[model samples]
Target chain A: MDTKIKTNNTTSEKIHSSENIDEQMLERLFRQFSQEIPDDGFTDRVMKSIAAVSQEESVSQKTAFSLKAQIPLLKSLNWFTAILSVAIFLFAGGPQLVWNSVFAPIFSNVTSILPVSVFRWTFDDWLVAFFRQAHQLYSIDVLTTPLPTIYILLAVLTALAARRLALLTV
Target chain B: MPSVTDIALVLQVVTIGSQRAFATLVERHQEPVRRFLRSLTNGDEALADDLAQETFIRAWQGLRSFRGSASFRTWVMRIAYHTFLDEVRKSKPTETLDSNQRIEPNATQTDNFMLRHDVQQALDSLSEIERTCITLQLIEGQSIADIATISGLPQNTVKSHLMRGKQHLTTYLRNHGYKD
Candidate 1:
């Protein structure tokens, strides 16, 4: 290998002189430097450390997940939400069954007492009114018609309660 | 086909508590980080190994803070660079001097090994920042931006260090009649 000292008088001169050096020479030097990477169980040591740390983190995560899974309030609240949702569906459809089984004859009899304008109403008007009243039965109307409204409110409260319980546990 | 993003996803999973993912990270990055630290510390294999371990530990500790703004490799390398610096700070001051004191590999060694050792000693003579720049740029083959991120130096500063390091190495090789 050749050994000869190159000199420079100024800072920029030194920088510029490096540019003049052959590209192949620089590439060779870089290749030589690259070859110096260590190979003696280095990765094993790093992997071992990483394994230790990751094991600790995994343990902590499992503990947190299990702790969240154990909260009684959250468990009860989830059940409450499911049951209340079913109750809401039954309440909304239950009135239709009542109308068909018991109230239809009574509704026909009450036509005489209803206003004469209602009696003169067209088929479309009667159909629209029936739908409108059914909507009223299904609607949550706490300030207006309290029964269905209370059911709706109960379902919403149950959902909110479950969510809050879950949050607390997590 | 695992792209860089796939590797990054593995790292992210590792950060969130996956041992297998962490192992993958170690396997992928160990060589480059070892090479970079070895070059920076002037081929102290034992120290390089220790620093490499410390780097992974530090990376694991700081994994949650990684924001994915940079490539996973760059981020891990930055952690390794900082860990090496922290180790330098904590160790006895004499270690730095010892590293700078050059030694021939072996008298009976082959010519290639001696030449490699000579180049390494010439590298050792560089200032710490210059050594870091040269190691990252030449040995690690990091881009300028990545070197700046790893070294925590400004881009211009990194460039200056690379230029100065090359000039110093060139002068050293010439003095030893190793210049082509």
Candidate 2:
């Protein structure tokens, strides 16, 4: 192993010494005859290209920044719409109005079309019974109902937060 | 005006996007960069200048990535080398004979031009990697490590190329009337 190491060292030294000789010869050749390229207008051309590149970069950056800047305004608009919808819904008696005008009528109509002879009640009477039951099921107190105002508002807020998070991830 | 260092110029260009500072850097290094390209292109002055211009432009665009490990000159030479390789890859195979035939010597230096012509001919005797290693080491005065970095070759490979390139160059120049 020692002998192999010594052999490698000697070989490397030989290569290095010969490499030095070649370097000297090359130096002589270049020192005597190497040309210096004159800069007639190269710098001007490069600077012009650089200016164009810089202009392109800045323009793109500005466009990206403007797009980013509009996000807050969009977010504010979304919040305003959400809040206004909730406010209009609550001011119109919330769940009670939804039950009376929307869900209760649908339930009453569905029952009115079904057979009502099983209980000796007329179709209209059955519909009236279903209407009262649905109204009670949905409840009259907006804040205390099954689908409470607070629960709906919380759901809306959670949805908005989730949407914002999705957009950010994108 | 006091001459600033390349590092200072580089700092100004990076921090402030100073075109004037970058222009100064281009002017300072253009000679060596152009000469290196001219050698690699085998004396095609027009192509050499075009490649050199591209090298500086790329350097400017990527100035922020310069880590100050190598001198600005070595870094730019690396860029010039890669730009030359990219051009070569994009084009047909190199016609050194045609390129040599295209060389128009400067009128003022007939004897030196003749010597340079002979040198270019001798350089033609080497393969591409050998010639690049030789040019980077001898003409551009880069170290073996620097050549490795510039060529993206290992140090041992660069050393081998240098050894072989030196032997070929010496034999060619010697046969062509360059006495020891």
Candidate 3:
């Protein structure tokens, strides 16, 4: 009976010791395996690649932002708002004829009032040259005849047709 | 806290187009990323290095989008994991192991080499997801939340994967005559 008890205790202790050994073995194995990884300029190569990529992206983003900034309409919220307000006025007024008539005159007046040095010519000189050139190029009646009205009417009709077609397809 | 501040400074420098800052970030994270990728790829050092490079490249491209919601390490690890998975998917399907074949030894007899070989072979036999879970949890020593973030899985799913991986490893070890 004592022998049987001793055998069972020995077996249990052996099993316990074996478990401990295995755990230790696993820990050691992990350490050795980790040490096998090469640190040979791997990080340096990665950093070089990252630096190249970052430089490329930064250049592209700066270029894009600078381009966007150069556009007066996109440079400031106030400019966008002003343009949007003008668009809203054009849309709400419902006088397509008035828009066509007023557009050229407003543009002409604004350009005329700006400093003559902007064009490298006096305003009067530019106006005289422009009208003289126009007279030399075409009949006065033909130059004065408005074409944007017809173009705008065609654009509106084409857009409505496109919308209808898109809706039908959907 | 110092590391956090350093990362923040590097981020600021990166934002202002500092190549040095980007290099610093890559240098700092490369080891962890390589370690994680090595485990995921089953000790393929070359593949891990390639994937690590790709991760840094992707991170550089997407740096502007990082919102500081998670640690940069977690974010970069997540990128590396996805890049690895993408490569895995694009490559041929993973070779399936025969159930009847015995696990092969990978290390020598000297100085616990057998133990290392057995552990590595057992790890190789596990499914990719299982390997990733085990690597993140045991090898990389990432927290559960960080593992979830890196694995892009829910926390519960990550836990399940870790549990299943451990169970599989235990069975493999026992079958290989390991007593633990």
Candidate 4:
């Protein structure tokens, strides 16, 4: 290694009597002085950073394929929207129907006997308005007439939420 | 085996995000890159090692751009050279505040307590390009053409830097009792 490092740069030289500027000698000294320090797990540390960075990249890639994210577009949501509407109505309307048929009469009788001046409890106006709006929404055919933009927004939001959930679990 | 065989293979594995294969590449190439950075930083082992880590990280990110136009070692050397330049430029202001900041690698105050006053005096005085060219040419035993490629200087420019750097180094050695 030392012998091969000798240079042939002889364009000029500064020699005084027995002394001379030597490129070959300079090359040798450079090699000798440049000591190689021992590597103490330098590679391991680098690999760890690489692992962390690559893991982040893979997570981003996985998020690209999230299930809920694939639910946009009315064409794709036709079946899902129908099923979702039915499930929503079942969960929301079930108690309402029971309340209207059974609880409303009982409540009315109880209130009639207990309230004249003190017990003045009627259904909250806001609650009634919310349920009324919910019923109107339930009556609309989701698959008919160019689907409301709110449904698309809801689907996108749900997809994004699903993606966030997937990332958290990871 | 050709050096590229190991580098190219491990590079493939790393592209698919395999840390193990990337570790192999790191292990194999760490010595030269670290050693190179060590000289560039004038034996500031900590800074050199940090820059070396940065070099490998950059290499890993830019692996796909390595089109095999040069050997992996040369490509890595190129990255390290640029990294060193960036570091030097970054550290230049602080270098003035402390005179001992830019000590020669072989300072008489450090390991080589007996090294005379003329130690790398000429090498120290050379321009950064000259210092880089000379270091790579001499210590690493790289060819002028390879140095040119690594430094992104023209071949002729590399030769000129090498010639001028050697002349000064020759004078520095002679004054320090280095006999031909």
- Model 4 Cα lDDT, one tens digit per residue, A34-86: 66656588988998887777788779878875744654533344445545654
Look at candidate 4 and tell me the lDDT of residue B151. Answer: 97
B1-180 in candidate 4: lDDT tens per residue?
645476566566646666666777778779888877866665566788899999998888888788877877888899999998887778774552232465534533754533422444555666778878887877778887789889999998887777667777776677677766
* Chain B TM-score against the true chain B, candidate 4: 0.82
Q: Write the per-residue lDDT of candidate 2 for residues B1-180, one digit (tens) a residue.
A: 437999999999989889999999898889989988888888788888889988998999898999999889889999999999998888876553355577566777687778888888777778888988888877778898888988899998898888878888888888888865
Which residue pairs in candidate 2 collide? none
In candidate 3, what are the lDDT values of residues B73-147, reduced to their tens digit? 889999999999888878765432232243344444454656655777878877888788777767667899998
Best model number under DockQ: 2
lDDT of 2 by residue, A21-91 (tens): 55666789977756666778889999998899889999999998887776664555465566566556654
**Segments in model 3 whose C-alpha atoms lie over 4 Å from true places:** A1-32, A36-38, A58-170, B1-6, B94-114
User: Weakest 10 consecutive residues, lDDT, candidate 1 chain A?
Assistant: A1-10
Model 3 lDDT per residue over A111-139, tens place? 67875443444433443465557668884
Q: What is the lDDT of every predicted structure here?
A: 0.71, 0.78, 0.67, 0.67
Worst 10 residues of 4 chain A by lDDT: A9-18
**Model 2 residue B51 lDDT score:** 92
| CAPRI-style grade of the A/B interface in model 3 | incorrect
lDDT of 2: 0.78
Give the Å shift of residue B99 in candidate 3: 16
Chain A alone, model 3, TM-score? Answer: 0.32
> How many backbone overlaps does candidate 1 show?
11
